[model samples]
Target: MIIFLRRKMSRSKECLMKYNSKKALLVTGERKLKNTSEKLFSELKVSPFYLNQLSEVLPFLSRENVDIIIFGSDTYQTQKETFSELLQTVSLNYPQSESIILARENDVPFVVSVLKFGSTHYIKYPVGIKELQSLMKSAMATQPAISPRLEKEPGKDSSRFGLIMGKSTKMQQVYAQMRHAAMTDIPVLLIGETGTGKDLAAQTIHQQSERSAQEYLPVNLGSLPNELVASELFGHEKGSFTGATHQHIGVFERATEGTVFLDEIDSVDEKVQISLLRLLEQKKFNRLGGKKTIKTDARIIAASNENLEELLRKGQFRQDLYYRLDVFRITMPPLREKIEDIPMLIEDFLTRFNKLFNKKVKKLDPECLEVLQAYNWPGNVRELKNIIQRAVLLAEGDRLYIHNLPPRLQKTRRSAHSISFRIGTPLDQIEKEVIKETLALTHNNRTQAAKLLGITRRALYNKLNKHKLK
Candidate 1:
């Protein structure tokens, strides 16, 4: 029996070497806890690669075979220092490794801050051995075994990631156009109203394209001064201008091998536009006050709230440049056209703010949502996000009622309420009136009204007939 037990233990050790040799690296200052962790892993039939400190483990990390890294509090604790430098080092070095941190309950706020810096999971220390094993198993099961910064699915319809959210047919059409634009390397022109997320659309294209691994640089052409526009885009050598203190790399140079998003491209002067056209055609440009021509390989993506074709016709923009950028165009639908997305947008904003402010804002009142749907969102998604953020910040309870909304939205709600009532209205007549109001509110769409009323189209028609109203 003793010989058999010894053979079984040897076989178990051999299996561990074959299957669990890709050991987890644990960094901790406490020797006693390190031993405890090792013992726990032994009971779980796993092996750990322990290091006394992060600096000591850095050498091992330089090797590609190290599977996972676990950072303990001793390595991350610093009073006067931010973790930015540490995160940059990790990102520049590993870029793909999964990093887990053992934190304290009180470190939740600090953990959240470091999350943006690249650290993955943060679990409270003194964790049960079972829980630790479960976490390890789950982490290993994940493809790539690393957390991704962007949540968007690769190769999905680009419009679905376009920062505009809706499931309506109109939105689907817009999404289709966005996907087609993303498939090519052509310069895309996005035309839409102010706050309509033209910039968002450009970013979605950048994220979805083959150039996704490269940098995505956004420049607001309308905000740059006319005199400085050329230098800003094409870089400047020393003494290029009186204020050009030293040699500078421009947006084009920084965005080489990547994408450069030009917002309000039509606002650029004709001379600037001509230089831009030359760069697009030749893929090369000279520095300001310099004779040497530098080559760039950046993809161009332009957007404008105003109509560039109209600008070209009115002699305000260069027609050649406009045509070059308009090879693939996407026009985003206004919020008023897809008001059905307002409720979803509102919920998304509220959930985001709830996490941001650590509040418990649960729901937006139905009346508040109705009011939001009725308003013509001239400022579009940007305005809606701002309003919801402000409301969430001011809300004192779980529910966001109409009174907590902006004054404009509140006034719209009052107007809607005033129009919804009538004197001496019968029960059946009131039902019909309510149905008609809902239908009109939904742009006279029967399908949408029926969904809103929680009834089928046939049932809604029956109600209309029973009320003896057309």
Candidate 2:
């Protein structure tokens, strides 16, 4: 009987061991991604530990047999090298474990490039909870039997690339174009408003392309002086001009085998345009005051806030040069066009600033978010980021209140007088009226109206019927 009891105990221990080995995941990020990931984890019935840095949870990773890892883009901040180091270490220590990176769509290419250095996959953020759950399950089921070779050599620094952050359908279309552009060596022209992240899009394409290993050099044509534009782009020979005290290599030469991003390309003078056109066609150019024709194999990616075609019509920009750079074109949409993405962006920026300023802001008050949604972001994503950062710094408590926002934003807040009402307005009638108004403003889109109401689709539908407006 004692022998039988010993065998039963052994069987029970084995079952407990197997149970302990099953791990869902751990999500590391600042506040934004942490909250999102937590919601996803809860919906999927998976437990996730949130940490600002990998180092803080290094013991957990070492002790727990985590099945999957979800890392946020904020892990790559200037001061935090631990995340990258942890990625390398995790690959070496737990070769069989599956790792996935979560990042904004614009940063997907950059994140993928970096994670690929460690043989990992990257997932774009603001991902649906169901989609995330599906991805995690798929990852677990298809765990690679063998480890892939690390592409990046040790001791080599990966080039810094720009990031684009949005998950809305409109932004998804832009992402598709970017990915298609990344597959080739074509010259791309990106036209967008000042704060729409034209530079970021250019960098993302370069990072996702075959030339990602090469250098990426950016030159702001608008910032250059006419007298110095040629010298800066084509370099200068010793004693070539007044300030030519030493030999210099231009952006084209420096960016060989990579990409040269010319911002405000419309600002280049006619002479510079001719030079640029020649380089684009012949891939060859001469230094200032030098006879030697140097060859460069750099991919050109140019951006402009102005309408190049209109500029061409007005004789401000060259028609031929415009065609040369327009082999592939991607236009970034203004923030107002994709307002549904504002919540995701706000969350991302909050997490970023939370880490930067070492604050633990928990949430943005519903009224504050409502005010933000109502206002038009004329400056696009950049302006939104700046505003959120400022608000976080000035915020008093855990939650970000409307009064904590800038004067401009506070002034835009809805006043009591602005609230709509009728003498016999029922609660349900009021809800339907608000929904109808929002839907009309959103062009009869239920999803957008639901977002504005801060409720799920089912909730919106239920409310629509309760008011007999279905």
lDDT of all predictions = 0.70, 0.72
What stretches of model 2 exceed 4 Å from their correct place?
A: 1-162, 416-418, 423-470
Poorest stretch of ten by lDDT in candidate 1: 1-10
Give the top-scoring candidate (TM-score). 2
Error of 2 at 83 (Å): 43
Which 10 residues in a row give candidate 2 its minimum summed lDDT?
1-10
lDDT of 1: 0.70
lDDT of 2 by residue, 1-470 (tens): 00000000111223333443435555555676666777777766666655566666556655555656777666665433566666765654454456777777676555655554333666677666666667776655544332112122233222212378776656756765665566567888998998999989988888876678899988998998899989888898999999789998998888878999999998888999999999999999999989999999999999999988889889998889989999888999988767778888888888999999888887898888877776667788889889999989987778899888888878765452145697888886777678887765545657656877789879989988777775
Model 2 lDDT, full chain set: 0.72
Query: What is the Cα-based lDDT of residue 441 in candidate 2?
Result: 50
**Which candidate gets the maximum lDDT versus the true structure?**
2
**RMSD (Cα, Å) of model 2:** 17.3
Separately for all candidates shown, the number of backbone clashes (residues 3 or more apart, or on different chains) is 0, 1
- The predictions' CA RMSDs to the true structure, in order, are 18.3, 17.3
